[model samples]
Structures are given as C-alpha cells and as structure tokens.
Target: MFFIYRLFLIILLLFTAVTTVFSQGTTKEEKRTLKKARKFLANEKYQLAQANYLKLLTLNSKDVVYNFEGGLSYYFADFEQAKSVPLFESALENSKEDTIPELCYYLARAYHINGDFEKSKEAFTHFKPFIKTSTKSGQELMKQSDYYININDNGKKQLANKNENTIIKNLGTSINSTYGEYAPVMKKNEQVLLFTSRRENGTSKKVDTDLLPYEDIYVAKQVNDNWQLITDKVELEKYIPKDLNTKKHDAGVIYSSDGNTLYTYKNDLIWKSILENGKWSNLVELDKNINSSQYNIPSVNLSKDGNTIYFTTTRKDGFGGKDIYKSSKNEEGKWNVAENLGDKINTKFDEDAPFISDDGKTIYFSSKGHDGIGGYDIYKSELTDNGWGKAENMGIPINSALDDIYLIVDEKEKNGFFASNRDGGIGGIDIYSLCINCPTKIINTINGLLVDNIETPIDGTLTTQLLSSNNPAETTQSKAGKFSFVTATTGKHQITVEAQ
Candidate 1:
C-alpha cells in the first residue's frame, strides 16, 4: 500500500524522504540524473527512468537506493528480470534492512521473478523466522514464498494435459510471440478472439526500457479452429498521436457477451469502448463509482449477462494490494458504487484477473495471497447462498511455478483458457487451452443479455435458470444486463429468468 503511494510520489518526496537515509556517495551529475529518473518514474515514464538508472549505476553500482529504484522501474514496467535481477541483488547486498521485513521481501521476490526459486527460497527462509513476527503483510509474503519454491520443485510433474485422457495445447504462433500474449476472451458465436499482447505489432511507436512496447488490445478471428491474425488491420492497436493506445498499458479486454461493447484495462484505469457501425468508439473511462485512477484496477471480467462487472483493484480500503470488487449496473443506466468481495476472496497480497463462468456458480481468479503453487496461480471458487466457497487451487497442468492468471471458461465448460508464463515455447505469457475433464462432456451452450419486462438493462437484480436434473452445469451472473449458461448434449435446456 505504501509502495504505491510512495512510488508514484517519488519525484516530490524522494530527495527528502529517501535520499538522505542512504547517503551513497554520488557526484552532482549523478544526483541530477537520479532526480530526473525518479521524476520519470513518478509520471510512469519507465523507459527513460531505466536509462537514467543505468547511468546512475555507472556512478555507483552498489548504491542501494539507485539499484532498488532501477530494479523497481524494470519490475513494474517491462518485467525484465535481466535488468531487475542484478540491480535488486546489488540493493540486497548493500541493504541494511535485510533482517528487516519489507526490504528482504523484495529481494526474495526479485529472485522469484528471475526464475531462481532456490535462491528465492534461501532468501525467504533466511529471514523467515524474523519475518513471521514483523508485520502481518510481511508474514503473508513469507508464507507465500514457501509455496512458490515448492511449486518450482514439483511443478514439472503436472501432466494433466499430457495424458491421453486430457489435452493441453498452446494457442500457437499466430496468437503468441517472444513477448507476452494473454487474457483470452471470445464472443458468443466464437467468431472473434480478443486477447492482450505486448509484441511488436507495427503499431505502437513507444517501447519501454526493455525495448518491449506497452500492452495493446488485439483481435483475431477463428479460422478452422485456429486464430488467424489479420496483420493488415489492428483494430485498436494504434499508439501514436495519442489515440486509443495512449502510449501506455491497455490490455485485459473482455466483451459485452453480445461482443459489442469493449472493456479494457490500463493498470489502474478501466475503460469501455463500444462497436459503433463495426468500428470501435473512443475509450471511455468507467465512472468514478467504479474507478479512482489513483487506485489500481489491473484486471476485470463481466458476467455473461453483463449486469455485473468483477474487477481486481488496489483500492485504498481493501485488505491488501488488489482485491476483487464488483458493481451492478442498475436499470437507470447508473453503476452502483463498487463493493469489495470480502476477505474470503481477497487476502493480504494481490488478487486479480477475476473470471466468472457462464452459470455464475464458478469464479476463477488469480491470487498471490492464496496457498497456490507459486507466484499467481489460478484458483476457482464457487458461489453459494453462504457466499463464495473456499477457493480451490486449479492445480497441476492449469498452474505452474511461475505466474498464471486471467482464466476464462467458455459457456460450454468442456474447454477453457487461461494465461500462464509457465516454462514453455512462447515467451512471456501465452494462452493455453484446457480440456475440463478427462473425457469431455457435450456442451450445449446458450448465452445472451438479460433485461426487465420493460427491456431496460438489469444487473444483479435478476437471476436466470437452466432447467435440468444437472441444472446449471455452468452458470455466469449478469453484469450490466448480459448473462450466459451451458448445459448438456442429450438433455433439453430451458432458459428461465426471474427478478431477485
């Protein structure tokens, strides 16, 4: 919490707040460069800041403050371990707070990001005894690190997808690259696939320090069960001239179930774009009721009915970093104030990339706070009258030792998709297809919008039903008046809606 508050305000406060504490000898020129770099970080200009940090390191490679801040810029911006690891290592070597709580925690985390699980484990375990009694949040991070290291050791055994009974397939070259491509969402007809990518798309003019550009929204269509990338036209990929891309992070997109209104994420902000006459409209930020650009709204998902929006936000009032929150769109077209999903769904660490399946009974999300294998493992929680049931880690093939997030299950429930940076061919984060059970079930799908008798938009106020002995095999709630459900192959499925 303080990191977000302090990091963003580094420019105005660093000289007074941190520079004096660590008096690393520096020349006047280096000090000036340090000030400039911190200012770049303040404005979210990461690339320039990284370059300045490189210059500062030339002056003082072991300067803890400079190394830490430089590593932070790389960590937060492009996520390049190559750049962040050494800097963080230097910071740790020069840090006096190794025995202290937060300082060592970051160093351990940096090691985790670098895929050095053994080193990460050593760092965390070295300070484990001290960390547990320090602070609640520090204790939480320490506990999570143990699980991360264990996953690293045991992750290779997961073969749920390799057996003849189950299958796992990467979305392949068209949809992936040496860069990251993640957060897959499909329209009702399965005609379009919208995913986020950070590859060189010949669109964005700006690239962060690691030479990778910002995340951009991209669209691909299915052709014979494969995604076809139309290299000629990138729907909303333009980054120059400050149009849709805004020269910043814009990814994590989902649709209105009808596949018209587009929802996007840019770190802390949530924006919507509508398809007007087959062209996307300008991005419009969600009302302040749901967004406070000051807080982070990293990932978002909507129920099939489009009545409610589930998002992970670092709102100040939350239990920790990024908590899942939801808001309903009333009949009057006004969004109700957002509400946190409570302690069960959130933790002392970050929780993000919430995906509520077709029937609304299942919710798949990613969390660093949960007792998952590592980093951010995708977990599933079911909603009952009592509230969300205890979240169960998806386990094995669905998760890995590295980060896995942004899980979305289709209405059919037989096949699903999730994003993972697991050790695989495609670089960064790639989307993977998961066949639910060993022998797949026949998935007769039904999805559409929900509305009141007057045809006015309805959200959480209305509930839909799919009648059968195995009723509502997969259910998704309504977000802003859209809903979806899937049933069986041989059985008849009837759609019923009632006001709550």
Candidate 2:
C-alpha cells in the first residue's frame, strides 16, 4: 500500500514538471509580453510580433498557441517564411486539426516558399475541406487554396528541370542588406543602379501599415566589375538628389532611355523627376489620367519616343486586381485616357512592374495570377498584329518560388537585372544580375560499374585522363563496384579500369 502511494506521488511530480515546461506562469512581465505579442499579431505588425513570440517560444517551446502564432508571425513577415514550417508542424502535432483548422493553409504557404511543393499541395488539400464556400471570406479562401494548388503543380514541374544554362548571381552585400531590396532599374550604360529598399538606414525610422520600414531609394555604382554603395555625402547627394527620397514611401519604376527622366512611385501615385544641370528637380505628378484618385499605380514605363506610358493599377474596372494599362499622349502632348492591355496580359490576380523594351513591341512584367510556380513570377508578353501575346513565365533560375519583379534587360539583351526574395539571398528581396545567352561552363561527371564476366561485383581501380595536352590524370579505386570521375574541360576523356 505504501509503494502504491509513493508511485502516485511520482506520477504527480512528473505531470507537474511536464506542465511547468510546456506552459508559462502568469508572471506580470510574461503576461505583458504575451498581450503585446497578441496585439501586434492582430494588428498585422508581424515583425514586432515575431520578436515577442520568439521570447515566449523560448520559455515554452511545447505550447500549441505559441507555436501556431509564432508560425503566423514568421509566415506573414515574408522574408524568413521557411522558419514557419517547423512551428506550424509542431502546432499541428500537439493539437487536433479541427481545433486549429487554419493551420494547413499557412503551412502550405510556408512550404511553397521553401520550395517543397509536394508537401505544400498536401497541406492545401487538407485545408480545402475546412473552408465553407457559403460565406464571402470562406469563398475567397477556397479560391485562394485552389489557386495555390495549381501553382504548386506548376512549381514542381518547372523546379524539377531548372534552367542550367543561365547564370543568375546575387549582387553582393554592397548592393543588398538584411532588409527587403526590390524594384531595380539600371541606366543604359549599366554603370549606375537604382533600387528601392526597406533597410534600417532610411531617412526616417518610421514603419508603414505592415510594420516594415517605409521604402527608400538607394543607389550603387559599378566599380571594378563589382557594385559599391554610394556612401560619400557629396556623391550620395549628387546621385540621390534632394526630395528624391522622402520619409514616406518612395520607389523606382524606370529610367528613361536618355537617363535624364526618372519615373517613380510615391504613396501609390506615379511621379517623375528630371535631371537638369547635374541635379534632379522636384517630383512632378503625372497627368490626372495616369494618376487615378481611386487606385494605386505601382509601376510605369515609357515608349522610346516618350509618347506612350505603360503602367500598372488596380482600379475597380480592371480585369481583377492590378492590370497593365497604356496611355498615349495626344497631339497637344496631353495624356489621354488609359486602355487596359486586355485578357491576354492581365488576370484576376495582380500584374505589376512593367518594363517596356526599347523597341516598344515587347514588355516584361511580374504577375501572380498566371501559370506561376509560386508567389509573383516575372513574365514577358510581346505585342503582335493581334494584340499582346499571352504572357510567358520567364522560367527558373530567373524566377524562383518567391517574388521576382522589375526585370530590365540591356539593349543588347546580353545581361539583365531583377529582384527576388528567394532563399540563399542576403535579404528578403535582393537584386540579382543574369547572364543572358552566356556560355555555361559545366563540369561533366563519369560513372562506371565494375563487374566480372559473370556479372558479379569486382574491386577495381578506375583511371581518368583528359584528352587535353599537359593535363594531369586522376584515379579512384572502386567502392562496391562503382567508380566516378569529374571532368573539368569539355574535351573527351579516356577511362581505364583495372581489376583487383
């Protein structure tokens, strides 16, 4: 009887310990932190919420609510989406699906950004049945889920056969930071680069509705084949120009062919600044026809002759969210009403960051509605006799399972630049340069199976000698009847096997 009582006490102690580890006490400081975190999350301040939840998670890693909310915080923060997958997984493991019905959708999004399309599809499938189509929000959720599933399928196909011939490389730390850097536009000579960033060094440390720092324009100049940030006060003032960057949001749209006129987006309106006498003039808002009071214009590009302007907007009359529109100047040089690019190039989702080629026959933009892999993918549509051709996705290595926007190619098309939030970047979104039609130097590998005439496994030494003159030969001993060699040159190589 005494042993039984002692055993009960042991069990009770174990239960208490487990509970203590998995849950936080009502301490005033912890309670305050939890309250602040929840408030920030509800208010869509994801970055701040993420910081607070990180503290709570450290204190109680096994709490279901903490894990789920923490997952959402990271998920919506947009930069480190991969960090959400494990937290969502933990939440789902500790709770019932019905109790956390929204978990699957977010988990799928996290998976999609991480390039795990198969898992993402499964999570989306699990989420579909929970959405009730009767309600408007529910119907929207259903549609969003279906959209993700379709794009996930596309992601799987495109990522499996990524473009190997194209070389895409990050622009390095000088041109990027740990914050979001996007919407890159370059001068015709490719000597100067102007991009938008939310880095901490902006004019004012103020945050926008999403709790991210307000956008600011930054400039970098090429030095010895590498980009260097223009940091000298005199150089920065010269390149940035007064009033070009403000405490409020400011972003780069495109640079004119002459590099004298700069089109920009400020507070959802299209504006332009002219470079005269080595200084940029104050921004002038575009014509009323181009700057609609009812919608936001995120991007714009000009015809070579500066007669027509292509811009992106989300007016209610648009095909859906944002769509590309063009406005041509009248005989009096006044802007005319805009015309939508039509169903061929626009969709029910967003289309933004249009860049018209110098020829004005082809335009490149970013879209989320088309047959995309994930997030927003860059696409190009060429104008034909029939109208704009169906936009073609710019395919992998140029576009990843993350937002890739604002692509601009040199007149020769030999090199191009864009921005993406794909993994392995130094920030949420970093500028990247692509070598167009450049030769790819790939190392080829040779593998051989060593076996006796009876087909039994045999130990052997494999030797590989390059056909090129004066190159050293390499040898590898077989391991379990297998041997391999890597060739550095494209030239033919000879392989000889010796049985042991």
Candidate 3:
C-alpha cells in the first residue's frame, strides 16, 4: 500500500515533467520506474538515478537505453565511474539498438583515464569515426576542437596528473543533492552557504528541459565542517518566495562582504536582496539600464568593497551568446549603466559567471570563446592599467571535457568552491572546494539584529571599527534586520548602528 501510494504521488510529479510516452510493449510499472529514473537523471541526481535504473534492469539486463543512462549517471556522479565502466561497455555493445554515440566516447574516455591504453585506443578509434564529417575539408565542429578526439585524450591525461597539490573534495549531501547545485556564496566566516539548485524545493510544478526543475536558491547551514544531511520528504530549510524564484530560472551569485546583501538571479535579471531584522525582502528589479528586461542577465559578482558589480548578460547587441559587463555605484550610491568588459574579456562564444577578487584586480570566470580544453573551462585575467587583460584557461585537472563554471576563491586564494558536472562527482553539477595550501585566514563571525523601537527592521547602516588595526567595515540593510562582519585582524572592535 505504501509503495502504491508513493508511486501515485511520484506519478503526479512526473506528470509535471514527463508525459506518458512509454514505448509500446513496456508495462505500466516499467513506465513509472523508467520515468522516475529519467527524472532523476535529468535532475543530475546520480544515486537515485542509478538505483532506479538498476530496478528497471531487473526486468531486462540488456536494455540499451537503461544501460546507457545508468552509465551516464554513474559517470557524471564521478564517485562511481570505476563501477560504471562496465555499464558503458554494455551500452556500447547495444549502441546500435539505441543510437548512443556517447557510449563509445565515454567508454573510451574511461579506459583512457584508467590507463588501459590498448583498450582506450580501440574505443577511441571507434568513437572518432562517428564524428560528423565536414563539407569543407578542415572545418568541422568548433575550430578549437579540430582534433577533438586527440585533444580530449591528451586533456584527460593532463587532468589525471595536474593539481596534485590542490585538494578538492565534495561538500556531501547537505548542500549538494543528486540534483544540480552551482554558484556558491558563503556567508561570514563560512558559517552558511547559499547557492542555486533544481531540487524539490522549487515551487514550480513543471519539468524544464526534459529534466530540470525551475532553479531556486537553497541555503545550507554548516554544522561544524559539514552541511546538514537532508532527510527525504522534509522541507528544505532555506528558500526565497515564488516572486523571487518564479517558475523561471533563478540563482545566487554572491553575498556582500558584510553578509547582509544577496546578489541573485531572477528571470535572468540580477537582483540584490537586503537582509534586515531576520527577514528577506522581495527582489526589486535593478537598474533598467543594466537589466534591460529585453535581454538575459544571468551571473553576477560584487566587489569586496561593495561599490561595483561584475555580471554576465546576453543582449541582442552583445558580442555573442553572453558578455561580461560591469557597473559602478555613482557618487550618490546608485548604479550607473553597465559597460561591457570589452573584446579582451568578451568573445564570440559565451562568457559569463564573473568573479572579481577581493582586490578587484584579479577576475575569474568561465568561457567557451577563449581557447579551452573543452566545453566551458574556468579562466583568469587581471585588470591592468591598459584594460582587462587577455584571459587564460586555469588548465587541465581543474577543467574537464565538460562544462566547468562559477569558479570562486577565498581572499587568500587558498580555499574556495566552484560548480561542475565533471565525471566522478556525486551528482550532477556538484559543488567542490579547492584548497591550494595557502595560509588559512583566522577570522571571527560577528552578527547582530538591528531593529527600531517597534522592533521592526528599519533601513540602517552598521559599522564595526577595529581600533587595533585602524580599520572599518560596513553592512547593507535588509528587511531581516540583521548585520554581520567577518574580520581576520585581531583588535578591540567597537560597533555602531545608524538608521536613516
């Protein structure tokens, strides 16, 4: 009875994304199981995906689609690629029955990564023949990937050996799920983390792009060093409203240094949320000149000083798919119209997800236009006296054959996080932290609630003065009536709160 009831509920959710389009000869149970599995796969939740697929395989071990998708789920999860190799081989054997070119490709890539050179060569030989031929002799695929097979094979080797000094680890189930998580921004002293997800937290009832739920912001509080493990069927603790989230895509890019302002994505327009008296406000559309409403404004980052914003947009008049732009606050503390970062940073292909360093001189972002190993690779550039300098790929181990984006780092460049769907992760687009052996910043997390006499959150500015260091920090006001300060310097500190 319980299983039946659960299936009934899932079927309703499945209807939001999946149609009843089972191939003839499949039973009702098979259809349900397959849809559930596919939904999990689409959401990039590998554990559930692999589990559901294994259930379906019980009915038929050699089901080509099942094997292919199962292999994909495992391969993408990265945590289970060794076990998935056989699944890929199985998919390859039945590839003719199901049209899975990627089966051969992934199998070849897996063997290559595992150092099975002979087997990898054989697989790669088979994989390359499937590449679509070009009408003009040399022009095929992207010019950068003219030797896609060879370059990918070499790039895999580079990824295998590089970055041995950098320790990268998964954030576990608390902040990440089988669903996608990206664009991580942590609060003061890393006490809390905010990012975007397509998990069940979304209010939208429909499935996007066959498997994606509407993107929504998810917050996870860190208990010690780990995120709280999410229990099944329980409501997620952190979220925004339907107005800010909507049925369309939304994501968070950065939180102000003071920890009171959240810069986020709503309907592809960048919006900032103020936190005051423990409440978050509705996202007001930012400057019309920057948002443009006619174009998409996806990713954004704020300066350490909070006076400038670096963002990405796809305007009709843009160089291409997307371009990085910047807007500086005027003397009156309002944003001026955004200006493109220029040809040095923008390119013919897509460039987005800009992360400006604390000094505002170093910039990190992902771009396909810049020469890369494959797909989207994280790149870095410096703001020089002349202009934004030419971008360079972060290279091999840090990048992969697939999309790698939203790379962010801490003040010391010693530790931070980024989102990637790279093979061998626990799920689709998981968040991974990178530690580069830099000295850890010893810091304190200072928090307080600012409310008027009525105890309601009111517009205010909170400043902390470090007497020893002769330094000062300011915070933004949100409806939540709260303020926070993260400081590394040790000194007697005095606090002040003023309301307009």
Candidate 4:
C-alpha cells in the first residue's frame, strides 16, 4: 500500500511538470510580444503599443498586467479614448491592493473623458486615499484630481446646456489627415487658410521630440468660394511661402494684422516673414525678450494692430505647465520683456492657443485647467475695466470632452476656424469651421494576403506595414498570411512585408 501511494505521488508530480512546460511554450510568443509593447509604450507610441497588447490579450484575456497597460495605451491615444474604460475595469478587479496604485486614478480619468461623470467620481474617490501628498508629483496629482472633481458639476451643467444654435463643421479629409492638424488661421478675407499638420511627408520625414511626425505649415485657397486643398505635393510647395516651412518643427501661429507679415513658431521660438512681391522673405527669429524660453512656446496670438504678441510657453517662473504671456512693441519698435497674463487667465495646468479678438478686449484660448470637462476646452475671457474677467467655458458642441483649440474668429465672429480631436472625425485633430449662429452639416482599409514568389499564399506569422508618402505607416500582423491596414488619408499605399 505504501509503494502504490508513492507511485501515485510521483505520477502527479511528473504530470504537473509537463503541464508547466506546455504553458511556458504557449506563452513564449506572448512574452516576446509584451516586451515589444512595453518598448512602444515607453516611447509614447500609444497606438502601436496597444496593438501589441491587443495581440497578447488574445492569448490570455484575463491577464491583469496586459489589461492595465492596454488601458493606459488607449487613454493617451489620439482618438477612441473611451476604449480604455473596460480595459481599466478588468485589470482593477483582479489586481491586489496597491499592486497597481494608479489603476483607479487612470480609470477615473478614462471615465471622465468618456463623459461618465458618476463612475469617474466614484473611481476618483476610490483612488484618493492612495495619494501621498508629501511628494511633488503626488501633490500635483492630488491637485489635478481635486480640480477634476470640482469641475464635474460644471461640466455636467455645460453638457446639459449645449448650444444647439452653433454649428461646428469639420474641414474634411482634404485638409485633415490621420496625423494631428491644428493651429488654424485664415486670411481676413477668408480666401486663404493656413494650419499646422504633422505628417510623414512633412519637411524632413523626421519625427519631432514627441516621436510623432514633425509639424509643417500648410496653405489652402478658396476656389470659386469653396475651399480646396492643393492635392499635388509640388503644387502645395508652390502655394506655401518659400523657406517658411523648414526641416525643423514649424507651424502657423498668426498672421500679422495687416496680413503682410506672417508670424510662425519654429524650433521652440517665434519667427516672422514678410510677404513681398508675392514671396515670403527668409524667416527672422523674434527678439529674445519674446522667445525667452528654451522649452516649447507652442502658440501665440496678436492684437489686431499686431503690436502686442500674446503667447504660451513652458518657461520656469510661470503659473503652471504652460502660461500665457504678452510682449508689446515699445516706442523704439523693440519688444518689451514679456509679462505673465496673471492668475485670471493662467492656471496650474496648461493654457495655450490664445486668439485675441479684433476689439482686443477679449481672448479665446484653450485650457486644460479651469473647469474643463476633461481634456483641453475652449474658454473666453473679457478684459474688464477692473481686470481680466473669469474664464467662461464655450460649452458643448464646441468644447468637447477632448481637446478643442486654436479658435480664430473673423471681425464679426460670424465664422471662424478651430481644431479638435473629438470623436466622429475622419482623423486625429481635424480642423473645423465654426459658425456661431448659422447652420452645420457634418480611412482607407487595405486587405492583403502574403504570398510567395510563385503567388501562393504562405501560412505563417507575418508582419506587414502600409507605407504612404503622405501619411505615417500602419502596421498589422497575420498568422494565416492575411493582413489588413487602415490608413488615415486617401493616398497611394505600398506594402512592406516582414517574415517572423
């Protein structure tokens, strides 16, 4: 009897060892894929990282770490931000206490971004006790979370009171792409439109500090009272001012009030070019007083006379991440040292993309602070006789739960242009035409089969990337030699195949 019991125990141990080996073999591919995903996440390539995580989820959907990381990837991505909610919830349920300390915090943010205020507040409450305010980062997190909580009431009120009278229409795929499009400025006559875009075909085919495509200024003209983009790359080059768009980061800030000079952002500084004889002169950097920061100065606006420049920068000694400052030309025509816009217009969070009204008494800007619903929201403040008035949110349909910025209105405020990354758009951060009181009316998927030289479909794990001259590459993997790629803009595509 003792020998039989010992034999049974030995067989049970041997079977357990065999099962462990099989499990490791099955998960080897997943482990390798997870490493790639982590690398992409570290690089801030959220979309690419989520793709890898999704592949891993297919191998083990119940993985807590995979779901947690996947949630973060979608949360930081350009569009489809609401997809993070389920992923976060799945991970939160299975994680041990404090094992994933910020899980609830991020889940709360996902809920807020998705406009689910009740769940957001609940998740935020659950995460609040874990914050250690002794540390600077923790203090900042606490402040941010408190701000979100306070704004929930106002955000809900604003959503309920959406202004249906206003009509905001997207500029369409011709002017927008999968890459971010923003900082839109139109000529006073509305005959010409200029904006900044990040695309594969941008100045040098190189990425910016964010690892995304570098920004480039693009120009479009109104043909027969209808806006038309220059589809031909050569024609686009002809339309854009010579040497205005460079190999480095460049974007349209604002045109000079008289429209003869163009103010632009280049390499974290402000630059200007004069339009002479239908040509733009070489770029000249702004005075050190205005371009004071070694860090980014992402946006600027000018008073109607163009004497005063209002800009946002991340220079130290500011109110927060990016503060608003103004520099005016002195009597000798040199810009005076910049002065902060003050607490009335700035906050502990980022504030940017200021648009000074023609009257110069009002400024419309985007803010991640204030009582924003979730991400950056458009707000306006009037310069009262006392001082700058309290910032008023523009309300829903114009200010979404996502980023909405770069609002430039005409003299009458009848029509204008802004940019947003809100859902229901054709691409990331599409430019939209704004009509205050008027009416409004609002990707290519590629399928491929991997084949041998003899045109026979090969069955194996294969990676494929769709390359476009005008857009970034889209990647996908297939196990049965079948793959598909969905691109942002309409353009010719080339397939690059790699065997695994």
The regions of model 3 sitting more than 4 angstroms off are 1-147, 150-157, 229-248, 276-279, 438-500
Which pairs of residues have clashing backbones in candidate 2? none
TM-score of 3: 0.64
Query: Please, what are the lDDT tens digits per residue for candidate 2 over residues 1-500?
Result: 00000000111211111222334435788888888998998786777998899898878787787898899887766456677888999987887434445667778888998889999999999878776666676666777789889999998888887877777767756777878787787766658888888889688788875556888888888876657787676786556567777898888757678777878888789888888999888888888999977887877888878889999888777889889999999999889999999998899988888888888888999888788997689899888999999988878878887888878887766578988878656657888888766686775878878899988767666767767754555555564576666555667787877785
Each prediction's whole-model lDDT (CA): 0.67, 0.77, 0.67, 0.74
- The TM-score leader among the candidates is 2
Residue-by-residue lDDT tens digits, candidate 3, 1-500 = 00000000111111113222223228898889888998998776778998898898778777777776777776666343555777778766755543445466667656644435456657767655454444332233223223445545556565656665555655655567767788887766756667888877576878776456878766676664546632322333233332455677777747788777766777667777776765666667788867876787778888999999888887666798788888999999899988888888888888878898999889999887666655677889998899889987777557766667888888876678888766545456788777765355676777777888888766455656677663434333332466666556676778777676
TM-score of each candidate structure, all chains considered together:
0.59, 0.76, 0.64, 0.74
Candidate 1: minimum summed lDDT over ten consecutive residues — where? Answer: 1-10
Candidate 4 to truth, TM: 0.74
lDDT of 4 at 373: 83
> Native-vs-model 2 lDDT?
0.77
Model 3 weakest lDDT span, ten residues long: 1-10
Report the candidate with higher lDDT, 2 versus 4. Answer: 2
By lDDT, the better pick of 1 and 2 is: 2
Which ranges of candidate 2 are over 4 A from the true structure? 1-63, 94-99, 236-240, 443-500
What is the C-alpha local distance difference test score of candidate 4?
0.74
Model 2, residue 123: distance off in Å is 1.7
lDDT winner between candidates 3 and 4: 4
